[model samples]
Target: MTARATADSEERAPWLPMVGLFLAQMLMSFNVAALPVSIGGMVEDFGVPPTAVSTAIVTYGLMVAALVMVGAKIGQRVGWLLVFRVVVAAFAGSALMMVLSPSVAWVIAAQAVAGASAAIIVPALVALIAANYRGTQQATAVGSLGSARALSGVSAFLIGGTLGTFVGWPPVFVIVLVLAVAVFLFSFRLRSAAGNKSVDIDVLAALLIGAAIVALTLGFNNLNGWGLLQATREAPFDVLGLSPAPLLVLVGIILGQGFLVWTRYRTGAGKVPLVSLSVLGSSRERAAVYAMFIVVALEAALNFTVPLYIQIVQGRTPFDTSLAMLPFNLTVFITATLVVRSYERFSPRVIGVFSFMLTTLALLWLSFVVTNNWETVPTILGLIVFGIGQGALVTLVFNVLVTAAPKELAGDVGSVRGTTQNLASAVGTAVAGAMLVGILSLNVGQAVINDVDIPDRLIAQVDLDQVNFVSNDQLREVLTRTDASEAEVDAAVRINTDARLRALKLGLLILAGVSALAILPASRLPGYRPGEIPETLVARDGPTGPDRDRSTDGTVLEK
Candidate 1:
């Protein structure tokens, strides 16, 4: 049977079913990429602060991360195809709500709906691929999903920015609505297996994991707002004068440990766990997870910092931000699509190590040569180099995870991927923001104490203690309200500009150090090349399933 299937695959690749899967991935990516572009317009329309709009983004990630494990179980209980179509329809409704939303609260609610749908879709994509394709074709299918993400990001930034500027923010989401309907139409061409009615969801496991994810995400997301260690004015509640953010993170870790203990207990008792521990059974698989987390966190940090420097510090428009980022995004899209060709030539361990080296080098180069202007040739080259590494790592680690697990556990692998990505993203953004602000404050304070051009009175007039990332123009405007002479104002603006630049450069250096450390885990990836995935795939029961031996794609092999 496996021989016949292999011969059939050699004759024709299953490209048709992949179209729907690719589009489904793009549907989610596009919505997320469009958010930052639409922020300005959303603020204008809803008459709310930008923070209110950002809450919607946070809400979306929180929901997806919190429910993804439960969602994977639900997909196993119900069918992937049926649930996928239903979620696509639900996502379309969220888009419609975005178009008709009357207030900021409505927008937040709409994203929550979209997030729930995405939770199921994330895991289902992996499961469906496992069911539909085999071997090389399955590898190609996996790479295509990465390309879809990069392509969607590029498209969303360019298209969403244009639409928001010329048409309106509401019209940006209309594309989402159209894409959802198109994906629903395309889904008819794909195939899925029947759901297992005997699958049971452990409620206690679900609560433990979900609460842990929620607390972790919120804790990281609010590190800057609520303070990292001490309580801040923005903190809603504190414990013994300490910030709730770190406490929440500590609590999340404890809960996560408890969940793992419970899962081990369940598995030993011969009951099905929410996610089979076997999916992460080997050191190689665990290494893949670690590498994935580091790469994703690095990507998220760069994504947040670049736009922040361009738009906020340089006072550029969203269109300008898109244009500046085009090189990096386009490079990522191209590399992710083509990196699979190299799999035939290199082992996973080699590729992983080489990719991390590229990322580390790129960040170090950027730290030294990057200017305030993102469009400069040196800066663009550095971004392109980093993109190549990032694109390859994302696809490679994902393929490792997919090939390592059995067909029945593909959904679990997907859930793990989604959780890692969302958590890394939140943590990356928060750390970058906090780190830059802290560096800027240190630099500003030194300047004030040493530079004789500025006086104590000038510092006292403005809130120097809470100094933020601001542009020269903004600083000057604030200084104008004070009874200061031209020399004092000029000195203050110079300090602000220099401090911001120094902070950005130092932050990139720190990120480079992180990328350098990631090579350790990358070296531990499987030493086998493409088509050499191990024969010891784990089953729901133990080391092997009841049926005959199967390929990574779930096709039965000759016994």
Candidate 2:
């Protein structure tokens, strides 16, 4: 009798609703991709160091990691359509705040709101797909989420870079506002799902998991600014003569264990838990997670390092940053979308190993070939190779994990993916920041000591230990206060430039080693053939046979 409700039922599996979902995914990822490119502009506008912008990046990721599970439960309780639309509106508000943010602090606050919106949006996207589609269509929709993310990265670098270079950094978020409104309007095409009023929110488990993420994020994030093990001058407090960073990390680990123990207890009592432990209960699943963590972390590190080098060290525009990074971003988008087509031909384990090797080789080659110029042919080729590897791994591991689980648990899989990805991103960016600054300090001190032209007094005038990424113009401004001759300023500039390049090269080598070591986990991935997602409840170890053989193995169909 109702026309609107009938139309909603008739438009089942329409492209419009999927467009809304894809744009939502893009809205979240594009903001993140653009942030790094705008680092130079933000630093110039706010008159802050690069670490300030880095902290904002970490803040956004930490918020998502801390709240995504809870966001999922809230979505189920309040109804997906209602929750999704509300967050989209809130996301628009956050974008407006970002556009008007007068200081870096406001920028951080805006991203905090955006991250909170995304916590719900990430899980909601998967839940919507499950509710709307079935069979091969459902699988394709799920796979598209990965491509949407990669494509948004490409769009962000191009669009955000152009705006940041010619216009201003504030305008980068204008696209987010536009997309949020568009998604909100098209969201009506999605089928409606009723809220489950009986679902209980697990508060204790929430606190434990949230605490664990905060402590871990803070501990890793402060390693460079605060002392890794001992008290540094920048540290806020120490624990019994030891730095609080390690103590916080220890606390985080303890809380994480506590959360797991509590989950087991809750499961025994037949009470709903924050996250289903069974998602990662098997070794195959755990290996998939480990592999996911490595690729995501490497991605975060490179994303941060490349922009910092281009903008601050080389004094390039964000548009130039876009052009320089375009080869990799475009390659990743293409590879992620096409990688799924190869699953039926090759096993995931085989593809994973090959991809990681490509990434490792690319990083090593880049470390050697990267000079002051990013437009060089060797650098472009290395980026393209790395992109292909990185993009393939991202899609493959995600497919392996999602397919291995039952279809009903897709929401849990999405939540796990979001948490692992954002947490790894936070850790990756923080670790890279710490590693680069730590290396830069070491090199600068050595260079200062070895070269008699730069005076010790000049080093004392500014805090050398608190070094952050700065442009040559910023460095020149700082030198204006010091009583230095023209030759002294030139010597300091050359020394800083050389030290930065050396530190970058060494840092890449370390990351290359990290990527190479990731092969151990990749080798542990399940030996399932392509296009085979086990539908039945697998053995505690994992399924041994292909999809068709899974039925006769006495495997119970999961509820």
Candidate 3:
């Protein structure tokens, strides 16, 4: 039998099934972007505090990190096509629930469901791509998947913002549901070709991993609150938000991770662990994984901060903000496709270095150009450059990681990649949020000093604690509460604007500096020609032969 026949005797062209999978994956990516845009509306509709509303975001990441490996194992057991279709259908249903949700609790529940489904769908797609395509074609499929994800991200913001403005945020979920349904219909064509095998899932390990992720993410999320209170306030008998005791969360994280390590060590004697920590036992893969974290952190920070700047500082409406980002998304989609096609021709290291250089330069340009009088043209151009660079960098990294792994171990590799990406995103958000808050606070204090014409001695006498951050509503409230004249309020407004602008500039500068550091590791990526399989691919599982049918438990079939 031919390789294609051996791989999937009943299926049609491999590319067709891949296309369907890609579209389903896009729905998950879309939700990630859409939630941020709709967060404010959710806050109002659900009457929840900012922290509570933000739970939707944290829970999504936590669920993906906790369950992705389990999902991958399940897919390998039942068949990728069955798992993909079922999970995607669940995702679509969850989205519909989100659209109809009337309360914050409902929204959180829906997001959790969606997140779990997404975790299953994503890793399965990675395994499916590995099984179906080889060489440059494999690289292209991976790149295309990355590009599609990026595009969906951009579209989620644009579409969600626009739809929310006209019909409210609920409609955005409805749109996602429609798209998911289309993908599901197409998935039917791919069923026969997918592998059906059996594997035992480590439920206890899954629980431990989930606990570890939750503790770690919650620790980072509350880090600022903890730091601020550490000096003045007594440490809560319960640390952060973990119950039972003051160091409960910290203890849980350490213990849970320890349990995971112990479990993996025990399992190594017989069955493969949920994630093969052994993959990074090699020096090269360790460095590659670290590089992946940095790249993801940078991307996540940029995505979060830039949109806020455009909407708040520039006074652009949400819809307009999304439209302004189109240039960036378009550049990413086009350039990423080009890079994937050409990656084999150049070293990944060379491509990665160039990508980082371009991204750093773009961020630097953005830092200079983001002013009170910023225009769409220059902002869009800078974003375009950043997007292109990020697209290429991410695609190259994904290709390297996937190709480096043994075929039997793709599920574990995908889990690690997914986990790293989520952890980086959570950390990046916390870091950026803290920096932005600190900068704004400083700016507000300076504005009070520079823009206010109040007597210096009188200003010194006023309690700084009495002053609040100046939002539009806060400005009005301050005018009503204070005995200040109209001119004084005007002066205060000017000072506030100056402080905000200054803070934005400083934040952008910091981001640019961080992006520049990516260049160092990117320079170390190995250069392999397009279409040429690396020595790693040849070493372990050479070309899969016709007689090699295997169960998910890694047992070869006797044909």
The global C-alpha lDDT for each of the candidates, from Candidate 1 onward, is: 0.88, 0.80, 0.70
lDDT of 2: 0.80
Clashing pairs in 1: none
Q: Which portions of model 1 show Cα errors greater than 4 Å?
A: 1-13, 533-559
Give the better candidate number (2 or 3) by TM-score: 2
Estimated TM-score per prediction? 0.95, 0.86, 0.84
Per-residue lDDT of 1-559 in model 1, one digit per residue for the tens?
0122333445355588889999999999999999999999999988899999999999999989988888999999998889999999999999999999999899999999999999999999999998888677878889889999999999999999899889999998999999999999988988889899999999999999999998998888888889889988899999999999999999999999999999999999999999887777767778889999999999999999999998999999888888888999999899999998887668888999999999999999999998888889999999999999999999999988887677888999999998988898898888888888888989999988899998888778887668789888888888889998999999888888888889999999999999999999999887656534344532233343223233334432222
lDDT of 3 at 210: 77
lDDT of 1 at 226: 90
Q: Judging by TM-score against the true structure, name the best candidate.
A: 1
lDDT of 3: 0.70
Candidate 3 residue-wise lDDT, 271-357, digit = tens: 756666654544345556777787788777776676666665555677776777677777877877788756635767778888888
* Candidate 2 root-mean-square deviation in Å: 6.2
lDDT of 1: 0.88
The list of candidate 3 runs beyond 4 A from truth reads 1-14, 43-52, 191-198, 224-260, 373-376, 446-479, 531-559
